[model samples]
Target: MPASIVEEFWRTQFATEPYRGGGFALTANPTLEEDRRAMLLVAADGTETAVVSPALAGVTATDAASFRAASAEAGARLHDPDLVHYLAADDRIGEETGHDIRLLTSADEDAFAAFEAGASEQDLDDAYVELDHWAVVGAFDGDELVCAASAYPWDDTQLADLGVLTLESHRGRGIARRVVRALAGEIIARGYEPQYRCQVDNAASIALARRAGFEVYGTWEPVSPDQ
Candidate 1:
């Protein structure tokens, strides 16, 4: 319930998806065709477990302290405590921005690289998280990529994840917002819902998602150090 915990959870999802920090585990991907499991983590008391991912096979605790002790005892093999509080944004929402953003694929490596540069390698690896179930979009300023977004391909039961980044020098032009909306629009067209989640403390990102027509569905908690 604490905002700090909420921010931690969202950051975990961010680190795993667009960044690939290897701090979390993968539950579902195109490669493993089991069942589409809920990525949301829940505590034993029915409270939404914060920071921990549902993909974790062992260890369960509701409170931050218990989970951390168990998680660490297990060699940190559990979900990152900082992963809770990530709010899934709605992809069904749309924006009226008229940017020239469009989808990009493997063939667009150059463009991806342009976006990848100065980005976390963890992101490059997990970029597939979106590609596996979302369409990736890139905004080009002439030949250079300035912004990007990805749409969800899964069902409403699944959470639609969105990530956007702007070239440092190109910030404040609303390019990130345009690309996010463009990708989210595509997801909606596919009959899937889109969700926007960002760190609670990331005022810039939270503002962008809000302006782009996304509302916070729920918040997850993060593991606390002293917990």
Candidate 2:
């Protein structure tokens, strides 16, 4: 990825309280989280391979046959009665039901505060800090921020990145769509490509990406145990 784009992605991830305990991790980081998480689960008697950070808990099988069997068993177990949503990502799934745009600013700490109040700890579990590379646009209803979209980290190698959100109370309306388009336009104006990712099973997010002219590049699993 281009250094600029890469830098921006990290910035947005760390911002808005979305990233809490888990810090920035690249796939090739010498100290891989997958290796670490696998070691933690060593007593389970399972072969291990690496999945990316923050998702799949970084557990796969070292042995192909054993891995396949374990994957099947894991899939079955994931669907069992106890686990609801075995692996979840902050995939930007839900829709905006009904709200007007209030356009937020950095000075509007109250909006961030409200956003923090309405946000889940899991939603806030990323760890990134600098955001000099990207720009942002937010949607608010009155003083309450119902949705937000940010554009940052654009350059030659990495695709431009966007981060978007809609409050839980706001769904089904075109609020998310509007904010996304607004953010995408901003990203284009800044001269970088835009890339988006969501959980494999998240229909709403997949639909939104397609609607916004994004194709599935690939899937990236997050691997922060704290998340």
TM-score attained by model 1: 0.54
Location of the lowest summed lDDT over 10 successive residues in candidate 2: 79-88
User: Global CA lDDT of candidate 2, please?
Assistant: 0.45
Across 71-105, the per-residue lDDT of candidate 1 in tens digits comes to 56644433332122222432244454556577877
* lDDT for each residue of candidate 2 in 1-227, tens digit (9 for 90 to 100): 22344335434432221122322222212333332321111101221222222443343554433433443443311111110111112223233334554335567677766776786665543211112326666677787877776655633344655656666787576777777766655655565555554455657766766665554432232322342
Note the Cα lDDT for every prediction shown.
Answer: 0.52, 0.45
The residue ranges of model 1 lying beyond 4 angstroms of the native Cα positions read 1-98, 118-133, 152-158, 221-227
Stretches of candidate 2 exceeding 4 Å from the true structure: 1-103, 126-133, 154-158, 220-227
Candidate 1 lDDT for residue 162 = 62
Q: Provide the TM-score for each candidate, comma-separated.
A: 0.54, 0.49
Per-residue error (Å), model 1, residue 88: 12
